[model samples]
Target: MNYLAHLFLAKDTPESLIGNLLGDFAKGSVKFLYTEEIRKGIELHRSVDTYTDSHPIFRASKRLIAQPRRKFSGILVDVFYDHFLARHWSEYSDVALEAFSSHVYKILVDNQAILPTSLLQIIPMMKAYDLLASYQEIGGIDNALRRIATRIRWQNNLADGIEDLIANYQQLEADFCAFFPELIDYAQTYCYQADRPLA
Candidate 1:
């Protein structure tokens, strides 16, 4: 799961969204900084990643990536899954994708003061680029991968794996459809048990 899935799994609150997004940025002992609900959101993010990595359906999707790019397969699958989620937004949620994205951006903006320094810097670019909504396009995924590849330490061709995404599109979409519903259900249960109700 990536930003979209993490946010989607989170309880609909500023704290939850912030905490979920923070999962990638913040590490080690940061849970003490947040209220319990936000802390649980961070936990939820980790739980989602664990579930995603272990699930057999997701494992199948990784095999679709070419062997050369297999080292970056999980990264590619994460972004590709977000693309499918954005494309099929209507099936998963009642809210319009544009409206949902707006709400998410607003949460990030409204809670900017408490955000980690890394997220504070990245959130502005996220909102300006409207990266969440742009996941509907292959070009968006390609650009995102290129950006990510540049940031990686190794000189690699993670960006070129976009062709694998295109080649295995339908099979991957099927894999996503099978896996995502289970994730949503699991996340809901996890959050319900772990997070306190919003005021």
Candidate 2:
């Protein structure tokens, strides 16, 4: 079984392992997101930095540090989401919160083996990007490109999570429990017989 699958099985059979597994997964997921986000942020920062530095409005305003501005903006947005919104907003915005959760769950399930649990942290941000992508007012190919970049960052984070941690353990347990009876039946039918080995 995959490490994550093993982790899931361990959760029920060896509860002591849960803490280590959760910790490992969390660290791994976080590292993955940090690496990917920083890389993308740098690239985007560079591009925007170059463009804005050359723009007449930016030049006139003396805002030549476009890269820092972009980076700061992203960091601020992330801080707001993580500190203020992540835990609290779901109470008021059920639809948006559910959509974000569902999207993260889908990604986690689809890439269970490769993604770390820590990376699931960015699911909300990715959902935000998804929402932006669907906007009709954004207009032009630039919006599409931005959306794609955001998504790629999201996917990269997902892959990193799978690599670092086993996620959706509860869901996996539920799935197994749901089908356990049938599995037991199959095991009994195929692997056991009435005239079995001696006691």
Candidate 3:
């Protein structure tokens, strides 16, 4: 899952949102890295990722990408799935996509003191671009892919990954629609467990 999916799956709270993104930025043992709730949120993010990667529907969606790009199919699929979620935001959340995105950005800003350095570095650009909301547009996905490609030191065709999404758009959207509900249920269960008050 990408930023949007991860954040959406997380409990709608400041710490949960930050930890959801931390799963990407924070590395190694987090035993003392964050508060209990935040740590659980990070764990929740990883759990969601594990389930997503192993899911048959998600695997089938990865197969939708054509060659050359097939090697990076997982990455392509993650971005495409986010696009579908953003495009169909109303199906999942009553909050407007832009409004939800602003809420997320505010949470990040308010908690910048506790965020990972990696996330801190990108927070400005993320909010400025309104990246989470921008995912609703293909151009935004294309720009995101290109930026990711630039980050890799070695040569790669990831920049051209947009073609895979365009060609397999229908199937990929179907895959997302089919798989997302399952993810939501799984994440909700995780949230329930995480949210239980201490006895």
| Candidate 2 lDDT over residue span 40-137, tens digit each | 22232232334433544323223211333333322222121222222333443444644544543454445444444464564455455543223212
What root-mean-square deviation over C-alphas does model 1 reach?
Answer: 2.6
- Scored against the true structure, residue 56 in model 1 reaches a CA lDDT of 99
Evaluated at residue 173, the lDDT of candidate 2 is 32
Window of ten residues with lowest summed lDDT in model 2: 1-10
* Best first by lDDT, ranked: 3, 1, 2
TM-score (all chains, Cα) for each model? 0.94, 0.20, 0.95
For 1-79, candidate 3 gives per-residue lDDT tens digits of 9999999998888888888889988888787889887888888888899999999999999988888889899999999
User: Each candidate: RMSD to true structure?
Assistant: 2.6, 21.5, 2.4
Give all candidates' CA lDDT scores: 0.88, 0.31, 0.90
What is the Cα-based TM-score of model 3? 0.95
Off by over 4 Å in 3: 194-199
Output the number of the TM-score-best candidate.
Answer: 3
Native-to-model Cα distance after best TM-score fit, residue 4 in candidate 3, in Å = 0.2
lDDT of 2 at 156: 26
